[model samples]
Target: MRSVYMDHSATTPVKPEVVEAMLPYFTEIYGNASSVHAFGREARKGVMSARNTIAEYIGASVDELFFTAGGTESDNWAIRGVAHANKQKGNHIITTTIEHHAVLHVCEMLEKEGFEVTYLKTDADGLISLKDLEAAIQPSTILISIMAVNNEIGTIQPIEEIGQIAKKHGVLFHTDAVQALGKIELDVNKQNIDLMSFSAHKLYGPKGIGALYVRKGTRIKNLMDGGAQEKKRRPGTENVPGIIGFGKAVELAAEGFEENNARLIRLRDKMIAGIEATIPYIRLNGHRTKRHPGNVNFCFEFIEGESLLLSLDLVGIAASSGSACTSGSLDPSHVLMAIGLTHEIAHGSLRLSLGEFTTDEDVDYVIEQLKPIVERLRSYSPLYEKATGGTR
Candidate 1:
């Protein structure tokens, strides 16, 4: 039985070069980055080098980048930290209804802390209205938190426009770019992004390391209270090995970004075309062209997404319904709901995200396998019969 893994947006497999780069940090250079001794200096060198590589990749200054555990921590720090630090400026934040739970939950927490939050809704194509965003601003609006690319649907938000709006209002702009970093072109300077969140695991680096880009002079309260690591913004013993891996991963991802993205985009479109040609009553999700290179999401009417996932797993095909973090939840994806998908349609949604490792043959195999699976599942669903006028 051949296997194909297509859930790269959730996380990517560690590249061989990244693993090799990190091996030394685990044994030979194992020391706390905060120490002044020779051993500590070695580890610190690795951390600083990694920071430089990441900062340069995103076109940010070295001093503006800070390391974190992963996207969740970075999102929390960006939102809560900015809210707390700017209380004198305002007590309101703006975000979209289709954001990852990381941003949504943190905004909810801030709401409880006496900060007001306005969730802007998305259109059918999963794009937020710039006018709606502009309208959401107020005298109390201090920040706007949005995702660069949606984790579930792969829709690219108009961050540059949003950034312009935020700048016009004198409000800080932060974006969770964990899903967009390696897949798209992002420059903090060109985008006018004040702060951004990143995760290495989503780009073929280690899982336990991430980074946050903070523009110079951006006021942000410390999330942790310990040693003066990460410029006192985030404190703890740094993951030296993970940082090394992340650096190597960033280098490798940048080198092959164009070639890999083109290949993945071809595979993505082939799969979408194949599935649409074979599967009936299927609604394609996300913007057809403005989405990520590897994202192919769809709704198979009447069949449950969990059932499709399990059946695909049986055939050694890995995919997802939404973000891996919320996969276990029985509720339909908030992202799907935000995009105007009904509960029944959202429950039947499936997301297949390609990656560098994905191949032409893998796409063909999945399309062939998925058609029968959907048909078989729909055969058992009475709703399918009713919707199809009992054709099955």
Candidate 2:
């Protein structure tokens, strides 16, 4: 059977062009970006060029962009760095309950270190209420970290509004734009976003490379405490090849962003509609319209997500329940629960995130295979009978 990948949110296949762009850096141009030799200059130039490309994509200054390992590192640095640096000004951080663990765990660590954290609740549609955000703010609030688009449900948050609120409150705003970078327009100035995180692998670029955009004049302590790389904010030898690949990927994504987004939206809608039409007792997750174009999450009542994932894998379909980092855990997604899903319903949720390489045939194959598998699971489910008011 042919394999169909629908888990782009977890990570996407590296684009061929991105791979080609990175090839020379590994062999011919291999050199430490910090060295002063000719090869090092070439490598350093590549890193700077990539930084410029990424900054252009997000409408940030090249000087403000700092390269990191990936989204998790970027997020950790942005949240922890700012919180620690600005502890004199405040010790409170505000964020939503639905954010990726990168931000949440960092906040937890800060909480243990004497900082207060406020986790705002999301509506059933996975949207954070501005009113709740306003209410959560205190005089000691230093930063607000929210994801640009939810990784699990694909719900796009009101980032610009949140930014405005943060600015009005004189608190810094950071967004984990790992899932939003390639799919949406990001203008840091217009949105008033102080810091933003992005990962390359999510946008068809090489893994192990991402960037954090810290707006000019935003004071934040360094996460890694060595070398002057990334202007002393993040220390370590730069990943030259990965940065080049990321630049190429960003260029390609920007070139065909609208076209690819529209195509993915149509495919996502078709997949969602087809599944709902064929599968009984299925509930869609996240906002119906204000969501990422490539994301479709659904909860098929009476079946566990792990069982569904296994069944889909048997039919050569690849998807996920939630974040790839937390896949092994038996606990239901916190994101699902945050959006008002019961634990049972949360356990039944599956996320199918499309990408540029996804096709109509892939969607159809999933729809064709999914219905029978769900039916089989429900047949063996005693809870199905109880929920549906039927005798097994």
Instruction: Kindly give the stretch of ten consecutive residues in candidate 1 with the minimal lDDT sum.
Output: 227-236
Evaluated against the true structure, the overall lDDT of model 2 is: 0.92
Backbone collision count in every prediction?
0, 0
Clashing pairs in 2: none
The per-residue C-alpha lDDT of model 1 at residue 314 equals 96
Segments in model 1 whose C-alpha atoms lie over 4 Å from true places: none
Segments in model 2 whose C-alpha atoms lie over 4 Å from true places: 389-392
Q: Please give, for residues 1-392, the per-residue lDDT of candidate 2 as tens digits.
A: 97999999999999889999999999999999999999999999998899899898888889999888999999998998898899999899999899999999999999999999999998999999999998899999999998999999999998999999999998899999999998988999889999999999999999899989998888798987888887877888889999999999999999999999999999999999999889888889999999999999999888899999999999899999988989999999999998888998899999999989899999999999998999889989988988778853
Find the candidate with the highest TM-score and give its number.
Answer: 1
Q: Give the CA lDDT, 0 to 100, for residue 67 in model 2.
A: 88
Whole-model lDDT values for every prediction: 0.93, 0.92
Quote the lDDT for 248 in model 2. Answer: 96
